[model samples]
Target: MSTVAVPELAVVSSPWSLGPLHLSNRVVMGSMHTGLEVQDDGGAGMAAFYRERAAGGAACIITGGIAVSDEARGGPDFAVFGVGGADERFRAAVDAVHDEGSTILAQLFHAGRYALAAGMVDRHGAPQRVVAPSALPWAAARGVVPTELTAAEVERTIEDFAAAARSARDTGFDGVEIMASEGYLINQFQSPLTNLRDDEWGGSPERRRRFTVAVVEAVRAAVPDLAVTIRLSGADLMPGSSTDDEVDALVHDLLPLGLDGISVGIGWHESRTPTVQAAVPHGAWLAYASRIARVVRASDHPEVRVIASNRMTDLRDGEAVLADGLLDAVALARPFLADPAIVDRSLAGSFDLVNTCIGCNQACLDRSIIGAPVSCLVNPRAAREVAFPARPTTDPKRVDVVGGGPAGLAAAVDAARRGHHVTLWEASDRLGGQFDLAALVPGKEDYAATVRAARAELADRGATVHLGHPATVADLAGSDAVVVATGVVPRAVDVPGADLPHVLSYEQALRDGVPAGTVAIIGGGGIGVDTAAFLTESPDEARRATEFGARWDVDVAETVVGDVPQRLPAAHRTLRPGPDVTVLRRSGKFGQGVGITSRWVALGRLRDAGVRMVGGVQEYLRIEPGVLWIRDEHGDEVGVPADSVVVCAGQEPALPTGDEADGRPTDGLVTGLQAAGVPVAVVGGARDARSVDAVRATSEALEAVRRLAP
Candidate 1:
């Protein structure tokens, strides 16, 4: 691999004056729910989290939804603007970002009926009824219906937005962005599918947009001196929702309002389309952005900047969209979580040095929807910066780290950066243990960037890395400390047909190859699901936004952009299914360990690929020449014909090879290191491997290395 992959980021690195707010660059750290806002310290913890990203090089920081009203909160964990001590904390956070020379914007938010929040109550402690334009229940909210805001209450809600903007201006925010996208309060009022009222809020398309337009008008009046913007659902992606023409009409209405910016956001929270997931291609929503940009530019107020956001990761890709001279900026949310210094690194012409976001959502989104503090899988230091500040060690010594997987690589990086002499050994020829195999899965090519980042970081810190070298007790005899991150090996499924030649482990299927023809997968864990996905390389995996819109029954005459919904008319070829794949679990949910935010998207891909999933395996009978017999719950014999069977039952901790001289079978090198009066640390899969998780692995490694003394 080369030292770096430089990005063409001229437009993104250039400064721009967005109305009253003069930004340092076009790379905006878009709003995301960090869960630190509602912490007991008010906003102190969140301030530290934001301060780091601003200092790292985000030009403008958009805060996660700051609740405008208690009843409209996204969740119970969201901090209401003037409630409790939030005002004081917001002021402190503003000062922190300003000290870093970055502009911060407070995004006034209201979740409406899409409140995934539970047990929400008002200031008086009575149960709060989630309010919306109509009394409709959010599809994913588990039958929780919202109260229809009376015409008077609707006016009050508009007032709430204005008050929040005034509070934000007084609290020292450089700008205010209205959170109207993602199926929130204002967006609910804009879409006819959710806003079914016959009143002034939702009779026609124009009336449906009245709520959002009024809020924008009020917010601008409250914060006349600050840069004001509103994030709008460019397509909404919902069936029977606002169409392209309707959204364009709304844009024209807002253009005359002299708003500072108009950000085009794609996909509502209830929409079936995959918005920011790994399956979605990079720059997927640029076309939606272009539509709004053209509308804004042709309007009377071209000075009102247009911003594109969604499924964007690279600065160069963002600049590519900006090079057309239509879009004023690009908004990125999760990528900043992966690498806060993404802009600074790219501007310095070292894009490869930046830790790219793989769109796994395991650490960030999965945690946020559950009201937990959001962190990054690739960069575990995010959100916990105050608790785990990076500091140089007073004393340095030799540190031998066994296993060059996620845990070991993380240990080496942490130790080396702290002034320790670090050495890493991996039994395999490659560094990434599971990540290398994971990268082979469709839509997961970014997994390879993690390996590249670890390798580059280790090399830069002068850490010794030995591939295909398994560390033994003798190898760690002279080390000050040892991190046994040897990782896990496949757990065999005990059954009559376990030894069949057709049976391949998950590792084998990923590395060697998945055999051609029909395939059967045993186990429905995350690995099993991914293996099944890898087995069938159907055209469905390459589905673009047009197909996504078509599948969801969305009207996309001018809304969606990308590959056409159907194969090119000139091809004149019928689509063929890739392969016949089946996943059989003993008795558990499919994609069990996968995050909620991405599990449905993965399952939907499998359905499109024609992959069948079968759960409730009563018993495994035997394997014949080309069929595996099994017993169902009804005691009926069934045979699944398959040319290959891959077992993804899971993994177990693996100790290093040839390291049990004293017959201490379980503790191999760890026992030797401990008995020799040398410090020893057993972390990651080497300690417990009931499951595979890079988040837990890296966090464990950080704490283990931090506790280790020379």
Candidate 2:
């Protein structure tokens, strides 16, 4: 890894073959459930989405879980093979990818017990009963238990996979990968924890393998000419589940099923392992892939390719893993969302230009928690490629983007790319307003990389950037139009004694490490959680999976023995070594405003670090020397002992106000600029400062630049 060079990444672009299917490169995109699948346009939107990624350099793209049957649907937007208009969607996606000179694979899926049965209905518009190998509830299910599948019903499910594969083949798919991993129906049968039945589909390890083996054999028999593959779980990562011997034996048994490839996935959806979050190290699951590859490559069918998936955010890490020659390919899903041209740029030795996925999950995974279309935090035009076409602007204008924050930088890059003569103005000495500050926190180191990439992008696009030069109203008179992205300013805490010398802001605590003493965070939003993490950690210790394992006292390399809570592994973090940190919130969720997928991970780490979280603060009595008093929700006065008080109450819009009585201008800067005859487009927090969301900021900024006046 230490010797891996940037040029060597061309290996990912090297052509590879899986059985009869020949791919253009080794870089493959795993399936991602973009909520666009269930659209009524006969998959026109999903097709465009895939076409854009393919054009951007995705070689072999796997379609998000296409339900084999209506009962197999995972959530609200699953595109079922034979249900409703899903086939139209599947056909459109296949045609779209093939039109781009790339290949597509239909991932035949079944949610089993993981399906939200309460919200879904069958083709007949009746409640689709959730069923699994055994009548068991998923660990995350809210009092929803699946009905046990009968032996005949299990056979029908296997045939459902076969039927789905045939539909895909007819629709012109290059391959079909059985969704047998991720605690899905097939995975449910493989693990004893979920399959507690004594029936033929579950009884023993051999019987457990029967369901998966049947699925593979049926799907292969259905589409023998297509590149048949399956995403199998190399490690269930669940305590009291299948053992290493069982998983390895399953991989070996599948080799005889005429499969073209096996992409080894890690952990079940309910597994108590932190495999995909930001805290996990890049390439953390490569060993598991290597483990499966050993069983595949050494078998009689040696040519069957094996792919390593999960947590490989950067293609360089994928290249490094492939350089070892243990695995045939690497599968990354979210990285492609960040930058569709990630592979092409990396292979061209322009890796720095790629907008890498930092594994934040703020935009992709978190949005999925609420059934929203997955987009990228860095690249706002991800799934909405058709809506936000990247075509060069027809009428380019002299665009001046104010404030060098994420919003402003995004607006500048977008405007410059659209062929506008762009000039960016920043009041501060540096760019990357919030991003630069976010980079100071451990495990968020890739944020700095984003900033660097944005700066380089701006320079490459020939945009003039001015540091330490705050553009006055008159300074922007030369511009055809102005984009005001002046982000936000941290709001001052209004509590009594908030002005005390010991009371510091979140920016201050993050920029300058807190003093060596007890620290109390007043708010528990995103910044407060980060501040708590920053204060409790010592730079002397490591972060990532290694740090996470040490802090939580869990073995990242091995599975835990019991179904104790699913604790995260890995993330460059420290234990209870530095100042004692406490996060107190007035009310609501402790990790509110944080992404759904990330909030739990952040709060879990905080708990593991001995950070006391106090919610239901009715009153902030006063901030004294060594203690801050507060009223609890139960009308109790509580003393929050602290040596330093950090305010994480949030931020407000940083915009100058103008004369509203004239009705000629909205804000002072915009009014002044407009009076000078300079058209203005207000964006980011400057328009309306509610919360500091990089997603909303970048999205709105790009939209602003897109609609900028001529």
Candidate topping TM-score: 1
Q: TM-score per candidate, in order?
A: 0.93, 0.92
lDDT of 1 by residue, 1-710 (tens): 01132457767777798888877788888999888777777567788888888887888999989999888888887888777788887887899899889999999999999886567786789886788888889767888888899999999999999999999998999999999888898999998888888988889998998988899899988989999999998888888888899999999988877599988898887777878788776776778888999998898888889898887777877877788689999999999988877878778787667788999898988898888878888778788877776678889988888998888877888788788999998989989887777777767767777777888878888999999887777777788888889889999988777788888999888777765667778888889889887766432334544565566554333222222122213232222243477888888679988888899998887888788888888987876657778887788899987777888988999877547534554366777677777788888888888877888988888778877842
Error of 2 at 218 (Å): 0.6
- For model 1, the superposed segments whose C-alpha errors exceed 4 Å read 1-7, 538-579, 660-667
- Please list the C-alpha lDDT of all candidates, in the order they appear: 0.81, 0.80
Which of the numbered candidates is closest to the native, going by highest lDDT?
Answer: 1
**Which RMSD values do the candidates have, in order?**
4.5, 5.1
Which whole-number lDDT from 0 to 100 does residue 684 have in model 1?
Answer: 83
* Alpha carbon lDDT at 20, candidate 2: 86
